[model samples]
Target: MGFPKHLTSAIIRLELPKNDGGLILTKNLYLSCDPYMRSRMSRSTEGSYVDSFTPGSPISGNGVSRVLDSSLPGFKKGDLIWGVINWEEYSLIKDTSSLIKIQHIDVPLSYYTGILGMPGVTAYVGFYEICSPKKGDTVFVSAASGAVGQLVGQFAKLYGCYVVGSAGSKEKVDLLKNKFGFDEAFNYKEEQDLNAALKRYFPNGIDIYFENVGGKMLDEVLRNMRHHGRIAACGMITQYNLDQPEGIQNLFLIVAKRIRMEGFLVFDYCHLYPKFLEMILPLIHEGKITYVEDIVEGLENAPAALIGLYSGKNVGKQVVAIAHE
Candidate 1:
């Protein structure tokens, strides 16, 4: 069995509770199916940031929902919010601290599940805060066609940096170079020698490396970093499934290059969401920024959609659309 084996059945249904005491019942509109969710599928969530998904229990992740019934003071019925929500149609959220009420409806409601929500904030904090790029910096992004990487490449370009991205397939490489406007990009799977491939694109060495697929790619990247280069260690999908995580042979470069490598969680930067949205929404409105979502129509397909992430099946941001506005 892959990460999630249980068939998410269509028969499993739940409606909003008529009354809630110190809780809010909501109708889940969109569910985010991401690689990170696999960490929760394990029997134990030890060493994992989020709690594990208990078997036979409702699985929850970042979602956009409509408040149906509320016994809380700040929340009211019919209000729109996005936060940790269950895989089912309706859910009762007791700890309301993580939730955010949707303020801007001009954009698509489903955006709250991807670019406008956690993944957006993730890219924002990782690039601007962690990477600390300067104008004319040479940047590289691995797995660049996904929800987060595409935005990072665009952000680097907006900062007047030369960006190169890598993906597993030709279609994604084309998306990076042609659609996302990356100066250069390549299909990593096609390259026989990753180090030489990186050298071809980044002749002067990478000033900022957005670390997505970690393992072999990271090993090659460490060899090509400029002095004082920064690496924002995002999700390392390559090491996630391995029985023993691959060791990087060239970590000595960190000391030699004075590189700063950091890992971040979107929650720590939640306070900056408003600022992030302000910068992105205008770009979106002016048609300067664009996002793509591969949405599965119903909840039942969530299992397959989530597992497909590891296989690189979904094209863009993988969103499980539950209910419409």
Candidate 2:
């Protein structure tokens, strides 16, 4: 009945495979568990940018790794990198296209899997590119304590926007307000009427919405959006596992309010990685921006950590530590 049921681990001999060319061997330090990976678990990923996982093969995701051996010219031995890697202690990456060398190591190596890696870029592109935010804008973020959501809220606050976020628990709500510096935050689970909750937060109307949780929450957000408002559709974690996803009732409001709802993929905006790092790295060092991670140690426990995202078990970004470098 749960995602954990579908996952099983097996042990193989600690041996290296013959590298013909363009392959790099790595010792995976940390693995990321993202909500989007749930879609990749399906047998068919018709139009998805990412391929479906092979039934009996290792599930791959973004991770921080130390290169042990390399047949590629760009990567050398002991070069730290972050990119698509397998869910194991060691991985032989056949595709070197996705990998990026990590130049900055002052921060935790595990941070390459969250704050300094994919989620960080996602927040950057989704907010800055997709949602054209301005100062004094009323911004709302759903699932705001998660990897991308937390960063989006903080970015909005730093940009002089009035930010509010909704999470599943009081602990995460408090983290959003007190830690991430959101103007206000509330627990969506405790709200009887989501539309009323949005009304309470934004009496005028929402100018920008960083959507992570879709379904009822999105429908409510549509009704409370201001004219010419923008919405960055980041992820719909609520609909990932459903056979029939819920439909939004207020989509008609998109036309009525002149709402700009756009969906984005991190890969599309990868050319801006340097720009993102330039902005985020300084904030991180100056302590102007903060990140929270719910890391579970050991590769064997990775399945449980990934499954925890759906039930709101993780308080922040969920990461699996395979081996520290």
lDDT of 1 by residue, 150-170 (tens): 999999998999999999888
lDDT of 1 at 165: 97
Badly placed stretches (over 4 Å) of model 2 are 1-19
Question: What shift in Å separates residue 307 of candidate 1 from its native position after superposition?
Answer: 0.9
Question: Which regions of candidate 1 deviate over 4 angstroms?
Answer: 7-19, 43-46
What local distance difference test score does each model get? 0.87, 0.90
CA lDDT, candidate 1, residue 189: 87
Residue-pair clashes per prediction, in order, are 0, 0
The residue-by-residue lDDT of candidate 2 on 1-325, one tens digit each, is 2354444556643444565657777888999999988878776656467888776677889999998878778988899999898887877777888889999999988888888999999999998899999999999999999999999999999999999999999999999989999999999999999999999999999999999999999999999999999999999999988888898888999998999999999989889999989999999999999999999998888999998999899999999998876
Model 1 gets an lDDT of: 0.87
Local error of candidate 2 at residue 85 (angstroms): 0.4
TM-score of each: 0.94, 0.95
